[model samples]
Structures are given as structure tokens and as C-alpha cells.
Target: MKKYYWTFIFLYAAFSTNAQVKYADSLLTAGYTQVAAVEYERVLFETQDPEVRNEAILKKAFCYKLLGQYNEAYQNLLRANLFDENDSINDRLRYESVLTAFMASKYNDSYNQYVQFKYYSKDTALVDQAKVIAVLALNEQQKWGLASELVSELNESYSLKLDTAELFAVSKRPKIRNLKKQQLATTFFPGYVLVREGQVTSGLLSFTLKSGIVFSTFYHIIDKLYFTALLSGGMYNVFYAGSTEHAIESIKVNNQKKITRFNEKVSNSLFKALETSNFLLF
Candidate 1:
């Protein structure tokens, strides 16, 4: 009778744990990620089975990742036992560790983790993933030369190679615009610097606005409209003083945008070359 009672308790606990896991999975599927994460934590606290605990932790990490809480996801992954003798779990944990670090903009840490994972992993697929992540991390760090070399070593497609080459070229030989020269140009002609920077629309708009203000001020002055002339002069002075600075800022922003787009293109090319869509979330 006592043995049967103990068996019943064990069975009840097992059933409860399974029910919790199923509920959490349902919540995750229903897009209640926050609730699902809490449920997973409950399962983690209640389950003694190593596999069940690991699954709960991984699912909770995924929930955090979906919520854009990469730091939380990374911390959760760190709680996983690495020497659990489960190759699949260990590989996924390492991969996610690198991924979360990268997502958090900890590029150096991501690169170092990838290096260690690559050296230790015998699995070809995991190694390939590590290589791709390492290259991406290096790119984020602005180590374009090293990233390009890794892409080459991976024997990526010709198009991807060209993309990396372009990235390297642009990174090394960027268009250097002198802010002082641009400011001087804007001082002489309100939109001259913008036009030179290929921002024709902005340049034309600036020119038209400034020209209108100046013409109105001069017209008021000539017509002896003293109050109107004073107001117009004030407007002109305000715009004239800020125009060069605005144009310089716009030029810098545009240049930075171009570099950002270049980097994105290289990153996309790298991901495409590795066919990361199968394994990667982004």
C-alpha cells in the first residue's frame, strides 16, 4: 500500500510537469511569449529531469530572444550545463550564446566564442555556422579585411566575393569630405554643398527657401516697410547662420548611411552564401 502511494505521487508529479510543458508550448504558439517564458521557468523549477530542464531553459531563451531581450537570453543560456553529454544541446547552446552576443552588439565576445566553438566542434554543420557567425561578428567590428579573407577561405560564390571586395574597398578608401569646405560652400551658396554631395533635392529645397527669404527681406527694405524688413532680416539671419551647419550635418549623415548600407549588403551576402536562412532567425 505504501509503495502504491509513492508510485501515485511520482506519476502525479510527472503528469503535472508534462502538462506545464504543453501549456507553455501552447502559449508560445499563441504568441504569448511573456507568459510562455514564465511557464517555462515554472517547469525549470519543478522538473528534475535534465532533458526537460534543458528544454525549458532553451524555450525560455527563445522567448526572450523573440522579445528582443538578448541579454536575458544570453544569461539563460549561460545557466545551461555544458557537460551534459548531449552533443545536440551543447551545440545549440554554444550557437545561441554566439548569436545572442552578436545580437547584443558584443561583437568581440561573439567572435571569440565562435573561435572557441569552431575549434572544439567536430560537427561540420556547426563549424560552418560558427564560421559564418565569426565573419559577421568581424564585419560588425569593422574588420572588413579579416572578414573578406574568411569569406574567401569559405569559397563563397563569385557574387558574394565581389560584395565583400566592394565592402573592403569602401571601408579602406571611403569618400572623405572636408566639413570646413562644405560649410564654406554652404556659406557662399545655401545648397551648393548638398548638390556636390549628390543631395540634389535637399539642395534645391534649401536654395529655394533661402532665396525666397532673402528676396522678401530686400523687397521689404526697399519698400520702406521697416517692421516687415526687420522681421524678414531676423528670419534670414537665423536661417543663414544655421544653413551651413545643417548642410554639413546632412552630408555627414548621408555618408554614414552609405557606409551602413554597404555593411548591410556585405552582411546579407555573407548570410546568403552560407544559406543561413535554414538555421538563423535573422
Candidate 2:
């Protein structure tokens, strides 16, 4: 009778764990990822089974990843034990760990994880996918030579090589701006720097504002309206000075934006290469 009671408890525990996992999976399928994550956590808390805990951790990490909490996702993947025991789960764990690390912009970590994954996993397809990620990770770190070598080994088309070359060229190109000259231009003419920076509308607006302020102040002074002139003078001092400083800063901002856009283009080119190869992990 005592043996039967122990058996009953074990059966109930197994059933309960299965039910929880199924429910979490359903929530995840329904796109209620946050709730699914919570349910997965509950499973982790109740289960001592290594396999169950690892699966729960993987699912929870996926939920976090979907929510763009990549660092958390990567950390959860780190909690997974029993590497190489189950090939399927191990591959998934390694892939997810690298992916989450990459998404979090921990490129070095992502690259290292990929190296480890590559060493163990026998799945050529998955290794190819990871190689793409590894190339990107190296690219992010400005390791152009390594990225080039890895990408070349991928045996992709010539266009990919061209795109990679373009990325390298763009990175090496000088940023478009002359800060000292822009500041000098702004000091002499409030909006000239902005106009030169191709922010024509903003430049015109700034110039019009300063022009109006100055005209109003001078007109009041000439009309012997001393108190009004004083007020206008105050506005002139504030707007003129502020506009000069702001114009230089605006040109700097625009220059930086152009640089950022260039960088984005480089990243997009790499992503496009991955897409062309059908190895885009996400």
C-alpha cells in the first residue's frame, strides 16, 4: 500500500509537469509570450528533472527574446545544463545562446559561443547558419580580414564579396563634416552651416528668426522706444547667441546622422547577404 502511494505521487507529479509544459506551449503558440514565460518559470521552479528544466529554460529564453529582452534571454540560456547529452537540445541551446548574445550586441560573446557550437555540432546546415552569425560578429568588431575570410569560405556568389567590400570601403571613408569651419560659419551667419549641411529648411527658419529679432530690436532703437528696445535687445541677444550655437550643433548632429546611416547600410548589406543565402536566423 505504501509502495502504491509513492507510485501515485510520482504519477501525479509527472502529469502535472506535462500539463504545465503543454499549457505554456499553448500560450506561446497563441503569442502570449509574457504569460508563457511566467508559466515556463513555474515549470522550472517545480521540476528537478534536468531535461524538463532545460526545456523550460529554453522556452523562457525564447519568450524573453521575442520581447527583445535579449540580455535576459542570453542569461537564461546560460542556466541550461547537460550540454552535448541531447544533441537536438544541445544544438538549440548553443544556437539560441549565440543568437541572444548577438541580439544583445555582445558580439564577442556571440562569436565565442559560435566557436564552441561549431566545434561540437555535426549539423552542417546549422553550422552554416552559425558561420553567418560569426562573420557578422567579426564584422561588428571591425575584424574585416577575418570576416572576409569567413565569408569567402561560405562559397557564396561574387555579389556578396562586392557587398562586403563596399562595407569595408564605407567604414574607411572619412566622415562628411568640417566642425571648425561649420562653427566659424555659424558664428558669422547663423544658418549658413545648416544650409551647407543640406538642412535647408531648418537653416532658412533659423535665419528668418534671427533676422526678425535683429530688425525688431533696431527698429525700436531708432524709434526712441527705449524700454521696448531694451526688451527687443534682450530677445536679440538670446536668439542670436542661441541660434549660432544651435546651428553648429545642428550641423554636427546632421553629420553624425549621416555616419549612422552609413553604418546601418553596411549592416543591412550583411543581412541581405544572409537573406540571399537563406541563412537569416531571424
Candidate 3:
């Protein structure tokens, strides 16, 4: 009688687990991913069977991933424990990990993971997809040189849908100027920095415009109270100082901004290309 009771208890547990899983599937079918994820988590915790637990965790991870909760998704993927480093399942998981990091704006992590995925997977199609993502990661970090090198390695037969010529053009380093000298020049002469940087016409134009504004403001005050003149001059001096500091910072950072714009343009193009190729991992 005791042995029969134990058998009945085992049957009840199995049936209960199956019912819970069925409910979770219904939630998923209804597009209630968050609710489904909770249900799956419950299953993952309660199920003693390794295979069922792994499948539950994997489903939960997918639900989180679809919701753009990458950290949670990656954690659950790891919890699935369905793959080893060299297994095909491991390769797919690595791809998902890299993509999740990319979506989270963790470009360096994505790039490093893609490198490993590429090296270990050795699946030509997956490796090619990794290359595209890796290049995009480098572009986001403004590592033009590395991005350009990766682009070169890509097979010409495959189109990334980017203007290859434009990519190369934008990746080339701009002519380096003496940054210190430019900063000093702008600090000393705020309105003339553009002129000194070979934009003499625009620089002088700006300087003239600012001087005109300053002088014009005081022109009417010449005949007014002495206090008014004093106030005007004080305000002019403050504006000049602030403008000088801003000009110095802008000059110093101009080269960096230039590179950033190029990278941004190329990265946008790369994304468009990926869309057409259906390479985005989602």
C-alpha cells in the first residue's frame, strides 16, 4: 500500500508539471511574453528533470530577449546550461550573446564575443554575419582603422549594401594638425580661430560680426550715463572670455568630432545593408 501511494504521488507531480507548461505555452501564443516568462521561470524552478528545466529556461530567455531585456536574457541563456564551448548549441548561444551585447550598446563586449564566435564556430555563414557585426562595433567606437581592415577582409562577392568607396574614403584619417597649437591659438583669439585654420574669410567675418555687435551695443551708451558704459563694457568682457574658452575647447575637439561623424555615417550605411541581407540577429 505504501509503494502504490508513492507511485500515485509521482504521477500527480508529472501531470501538474505538464499542466503548468501547457498554460505557459498558451500565454506565449497569446503574445503575453512577460507573463509567459514568469510561468516558465516557475517551471524551471519546479521541474526536477534536466531537459525540461533547460527547455523552460531557454524559453524564458527568448521571452526576455524579445522584450529587449538583454542582461536578463543572457543570464537565463546561461542558466539553460544546454551547451558547452565547442558544441553547436554553444555556437548559437555565443551568437545570441554577441547580439544581445550589441543591442545593449556594449560594443566592445559584442566585438570580443564576435571574435571568439568567429574563431570557434568556423561556420562560414555565421562567421560572415559576425564579421558584419564586428565591423559595425568598431565603427561605433570610432576605430576607423580596425573597421577599414575588417571591411577589406570581407569577400567582394558579398555585398554589405554600403558604398564600399565611400566607406574607404571616410575611414581614412584626416590630415593631422598640431592640436596644442590650435587650442592655444583659439584661446588667445576666439573669433579668429577659423581664420587661422585656413578659414580666414569666415573667421574674419565672425570676428567682424561680434565686434560690430559689441560696439553697436555701446554706441548708444556713449552719450548716456557713465554707469551704462561701464555695465556694457563689463558684459562685453564676460562674453569675450566665455567665447574664447568655448573656441579653445571646440578647436581641440574638432578632429575627434570629424572622425565621429564619419563613423556615424558608415555605421548607418552598414545597418541598412544588414537589413537587406537579413543579417540582423534580432
* Pairs with backbone N, CA or C atoms under 3 Å apart (clashes), candidate 3: none
Q: How does candidate 3 fare on TM-score?
A: 0.57
lDDT score at residue 9, model 3, on the 0-100 scale: 28
lDDT computed for candidate 2: 0.74
* Candidate 2 residue-wise lDDT, 1-282, digit = tens: 234323432342343347788788778767798998999999989987787787788778877877879999999999888463667667878887888898899999999999898898987677777777787787666566777666676646334544445556645643667777777777668778778777789888888887787788889889998899899888877876776777777766877676556546656776666567546344
Worst 10-residue lDDT window for candidate 1 reads 1-10
**Each model's Cα RMSD:** 9.6, 9.5, 10.8
* Most lDDT-accurate candidate: 2
CA lDDT of every candidate: 0.73, 0.74, 0.66
> Which of 2 and 3 is ahead in TM-score?
2
Q: List the candidate numbers ranked by lDDT, top first.
A: 2, 1, 3
Question: How displaced is residue 88 in candidate 1, in Å?
Answer: 2.8
| Tens-digit lDDT string for candidate 1 (1-282) | 234323432342343346778788778767798998999999989988776777677778778887889888888887887667767667767877888888888889888878867776667666666677778788766677887787776655233334556656754544657788778878879888878777789788889888998899889989999899899889877887776777888888877676567668776766665564344323
**Model 1 lDDT vs. the true structure?**
0.73
lDDT of 2 at 57: 82
User: TM-score of every model?
Assistant: 0.59, 0.58, 0.57
